[model samples]
Target: MDLLSLDFLILAGVMLAAGAATGVLAGVFGVGGGALMVPVLFEVFGLLGVADQVRMQLAVGTSLAIIIPTSVRSYLGHRARGAVDMTLLRNWAVPIVLGVVLGAGIARFAPPSVFMGVFVFVAGVNAIKLISGTRRWDIASDLPGGLLLRAYGGVIGLLSSLIGIGGGQVANIIMTLHGRAIHQAVATSAGIGVLISIPGTFGYILAGLGQPGLPVDALGYVSLMGVMLFVPTTVLTANLGVRLAHALSRRSLEMAFGVFLAIVSVRFLYAMFAG
Candidate 1:
């Protein structure tokens, strides 16, 4: 949280760039940067000698806290592009909202290390699937797809509740593999991320009360300072990424982001197992 010297300024600049790139990738892929952001935050928190128990929480909580504003603006940007399915959102939102609240409440009481392990493992599986070109996009029909969508949202809510990120990866992977157009999937996924993050962020915040030895500048495990610094740049960058997607091939971007997530997942799992 200190910005007293040139070193702090340099770190801040790096983090800012990270935040912006994070959002761009999120918008481009509907990932909300969790795959990258948590690692970045954990590395930073580790450098700061943040306690072991609280480090992952700090990473998770801080990322979610940052996404609140960023996702709102990003969602609106996508909505403007006709990428979002507002009707679809209305259908999915009700169950997702309820599920998110339940998930957050669980995170508030769950064990942090166990939570981090699960997050790392799931990300690893998803990343591996992407890297191996083994992803499937098949869906039965509207009824099955709707059920699948609800399930994705539910799982995303639960995961995001614990990890403090937008649930875009889950939504993105599911929808894209199920034959949703990439642009629409990414846009709709961002909206889903926004929906889940709003509750998940606060859930992580409240959950931090279950562990009091977190960092100084945090609300629960999330750094309020990190959120304040990140949200603005991320919002702008997400919009930029959306614009770039329009001018570029979305399949290419998905492959790229998928590769990136795989790398990140490997790193996260390595750290988790190493620890």
Candidate 2:
């Protein structure tokens, strides 16, 4: 926790770099920060030798904490440009928030070995599907029923909380396949992520039960190290990414991020399954 400690300084630097990168990616992809933060956190947890018991929860919680700021930054630009769907946001956010809270609570006590195995399997499957071009962006929010919508949101929340991701990857695919426009789906999912992170961070903090050596100035499972180092960088860089989004081709950026996601997913699979 000491600012002058060499370990803290080094971790801060690494987090800053990852935060900036996440900003650029968010700007380009119209998603929250976890696309980049999750992978980085996984590696950080591994390096820190955090116990398997809570490492996954910490990573997920830390990713959600970063999302609080990063998603707001990404959404501001979209709201200004009228890309966000306020109606859809209102319709789904409540259920999604509830889902995130419940998911976080469950993850806090679940066995890490089970979570990691599932994480690796899902990431690998998602990556392969992307590589095959079966998961390209589109638009569709066709929830067959209100019950299904809540259930889907809950499932996404569960997976997201378990993995420390924003859930945009799955949300986007689900929405677009149902007939929602890609941009609208991206924007709305950002709103859902905001809901997920705000409640989910608190959930993990409460569930963490105050593990020791959690680095300096930490809040339960959410790494104070990552949140402090990454949040500001993410906000600033996300603004820049927004500008770039307006100037560049949105589809191009999305495609690029897709490839990046596959690479990161492979890394995650290796870290969990191979480890």
| CA lDDT of each prediction against the hidden true structure | 0.71, 0.71
Model 1 CA lDDT for position 29:
70
Top TM-score model: 1
What range of 10 consecutive residues in model 1 has the weakest lDDT sum?
135-144
Clash counts for the predictions, in order = 2, 11
Residue 75, candidate 2: Cα error in Å is: 1.2
> Model 1 reaches what TM-score against the true structure?
0.84
Candidate 1 — what's its lDDT? 0.71
Q: After best superposition, candidate 1 residue 212: deviation in angstroms?
A: 2.6
Q: Mind giving the per-residue lDDT tens digits that candidate 2 earns over 1-275? A: 67558776787789999889888766655667675687678778768777766666677788888988887778787788887878767767777777777778778666655755665555455445444555443233365557777777777777677667676766765665666655676667766677777888888888776676565555888888778888888888887877776665645544554576577566665666675
